[model samples]
Target: MAAPPTDSFTEFQTNLTQTKAQSTTTNGNTVSRGPSPNRGASVPDNEAIGPESTTQQKWLTEHGIDKSKWVKLKRLNHMRYQHEDLNVITTFLKDFGVKVVKKTETERWYAGYGPDQYVYYARQGPRKFLGGVFEVDSREDLEKLVRDHADTLQTKGIEEMTTAPGGGSIVTILDPEGFPVNFVHGQSQRAPQQMPEKLVVNDESTKPRARQFQRFSPGPAAVHKLGHFGLVSAKFDVLREWYTTHFNIVPSDMLYIDLPNGGRKEVAMFAHLDLGQDLVDHHSLFLATLTPDSSIPEPHVHHCSFEVHDFDTQALGHQWLAEKGYQNVWGVGRHILGSQIFDYWWDTSKFMVEHYADGDLVNEDTAVGYGPAGHEGLAVWGPDVPQEFLH
Candidate 1:
């Protein structure tokens, strides 16, 4: 197959550089632009880099998938899980910014301050990572998915979701690595909660308000929505292909590692749901390659992240968690890739969960970036990356 036109790639690089410029500027001073002159005056030389190549598009074409056939995923709806003790987990989730939406003797659904009914679903059972769930555009899309990937479809057809909140029809499918992915349709929408008022800022030149008043109170950070989640996969390539082919997910960025034979191999990916011109979070899902060299035993969910209101909310939330004596994984730093002010913690069940604010938003036109995969690559400014967090 022929390569995709280079025009898009060129435009993407130009836009990316401009975005970086805007982001790094503070109080009217621009940060160092790109690589320094002493460092060769070019893009940094690293195994990991941005997604300027037509590799992703070319891979799609090779697999006989085109833009039209790509599944239309609306957004990441919620995550499903099983816990040993519902009461303990529920208490932790409440403190973590989720409110109980609905509950029963065996199951419970918790929601953030968003329109969608829930952001998390849990059941009383053995601890297990059920999977991340997605809301699709239509029942037709779900039917088409079954037709195309019948081998992997766990449900024979669209099955009514009687137990979940805002009942919908769902079909579960297993990814190449056996992760259960459920696509839902016809779920009832809830009234969106009122958004917090934007705080007035006093800039160097312009002070928005005449009076400066302190804002913020001690409490759990109210999550606005589900932002993203990640998994460490041994078969990263296979999982990447499975997601991209079956859904309208695209790579926002990729991380590469140096090969013993020379050159580099793509290992970690930050991917987003593509909705054409509509903007969405920088990444709704993250995938990292784990091997014996990385000291990770097996593939598993790394963390599920939710978006809070702002930096102040995040800081307060971190404080709240710290005071409560929740185990900290890593955090209170900004990531270089997605530009989110992030903090992570271990839930009562020992699963990693994260609270992030001020994340980058991207549309289909955004460029996919490539970068080195390491603790340093993970954040621009933060405390040292924890060893447990890396694995």
Candidate 2:
């Protein structure tokens, strides 16, 4: 592949326009736009790190896994955490755009403005990475998972999630690194909140709104849904295999670094839940391999991300967090792979959290891509990548 285009906002806009134009099609007398944009330009490559390769496809075929047997994960449901003080975490969550849906003496369920019943669940306890939650297609799907992997599943049987906002059945499985992975099914859906209207802009060539009155109050960016989360893992290969085999998650992109001998070793992966013909976010989960050269020695949750309204909402939220004295990580930029306008910050738990908007969506038809890993590979237009975020 040729070198990636230079990181510039102007180039991004131009490419976006070209992609939109290419996506339009006409049949008979009717014209319609495709569901996704052309993603060729989003693929990253680096001469310094070595040549890129789409090894994920070969790996999957070699495994000979049948898709019909894998558990169908619909989307990310919520993230669970254990905190010493619920009040502190609650305050932080509110500031981050989550509202308290239901609270008890021991547990609290916080929800965003989106359709999900809740986006985050916190309980009073010692700090612990309880793990992320995913929604499965049906109860039979969860049963099939237990029946097929009886030896590996952590929970003996499905547990009734009565305490949660949307009562459901849950089964927890432990990954190779002993992180809890919860799968839920039969949960009732919540009605979506009214989304803010998309703002109309007046460019030099075209002005849509005659009376322009756009005003925004400085506050938390209203979150739409849980987009994705990432983890730094020492046992990357093991966890990767476990996730890919158990669920219908496929790699959107892989990042590799040159090895000392000659070949390349994949160091990171950005994978999304595959719903076949259904379109979803580019990535619902990301995993970075921990190596000797890594800045952080231990395994940790890198970050959890939420989708917001749009560019203006993200900018105002970034300002809100800045004024609230939260430490910024890296963002206010567009990512090359996901094409999301992003802003990352350090939460009260010292874990990275992100607010993003205008992200690309794809289905199973999207091809997997490979790239080189580095600061430049992180974003196409943003402030210098922070050292703390890389690890």
Candidate 3:
């Protein structure tokens, strides 16, 4: 949308350098514990692990990701809203496949999709937002986690849990970085009653001869679940440290950027992390490098992505966005690591969004790679960077 502010990188570098130097002596004494069966937790580490590229991927895979089983990312529910017009906000998400299913008189709405996580959006009069919900396995699991979190947070009374659309329950908590997060259990089917009615996009050019099946159809909405979120912050180290400390997330890879193609400004490399097995997608969250003069706003969401079932869905998304007058930032490229093919675009508000297909799956043994901060690294499968995207 709005070209991220200029100098975003500069501010990131300056703050990071200071963060590295401003060490807290209290870090070593902290104890590590898993999430309470009821409450959510934060990552425990602040600094990046050694650049032992070869085993990072394998290490992650061993933890729990079955790339082949990953159907599609649904939706990440955001409580924070920058708008007051409920219609405008709901309209935008609905156009992109999110639907408002239920709500309270206070303007809080629960949006659900057959394929993705249910999102809860509540209007806090204009700017205030609340915690979000992530779809999980069952209501019992949700209650247990919420109850555990309350214990960890040491809330004296047991907290009541919320119900979700797909026959599941939800637990809300504040992450180590002070971000509100909710976990959901059990999903109730709400759309596309018939198997024949399901519209699936196919990425494969040909079907296996031995496996003869009927052609598939397209479904109502392409996005099935919430994928991941990227956040921008001036307090890089503080947020980074906070996340790792509270959650079990670990740094799978890290990057440092040097701008202008040859300057010693050494402060521009963006920091990246993977949330491991407790979450979905390659990275549940990404923190870009920031500078005071940087184009992006401080502590802002860089972009959020939705997963498409196949190449057909991905292509349809690209066409839809183009016809609707949106910016197609980057696309149709496969990543070397996550291996998912993706296309990027901006909404009317300039918030960056991605519709991706076939992302690469990583396991404990997958090798991690690094390169200078540039477009070439972002998309391992696309044609050379489009000049327009460089801007």
In terms of lDDT, the best-performing candidate is 1
lDDT per residue for candidate 3 within 64-88, as digits (tens), equals 5444322122324433344456665
Candidate 2 per-residue lDDT, tens place, 1-391, comes to 2224667544665666665565334574535454443343433322211334344456568767567768899999999889889998888888888899999999999999888999999999988778898999899988886787676687768989888888999998777777788899988989867988988998789999788888888999988899998988999888888788878988888888889899988888888998877888989999988767667798888888999999989898888888888889987999877888899988787777899998877766666778888878778788998778887
Native-to-model Cα distance after best TM-score fit, residue 333 in candidate 2, in Å: 1.7
- TM-score between candidate 3 and the true structure: 0.58
**Can you list the residue pairs that collide in candidate 1?**
49-370, 49-371, 50-369, 50-370, 51-368
Give each model a TM-score.
0.84, 0.84, 0.58
lDDT of 1: 0.83
Ranking 1 against 2 by lDDT, winner: 1
Per-residue lDDT of model 1, residues 68-150, tens digit only:
87789999999989999999999999889999989999999999988889999999999999899899999998898788878
Separately for all candidates shown, the number of backbone clashes (residues 3 or more apart, or on different chains) is 5, 0, 74
Candidate 3 global CA lDDT score: 0.49
Question: Which model, 2 or 3, shows the larger lDDT?
Answer: 2
- Stretches of candidate 3 off by over 4 Å are 1-82, 104-117, 120-124, 127-179, 182-221, 258-280, 365-371, 381-391
Candidate 1 vs candidate 3, lDDT winner = 1
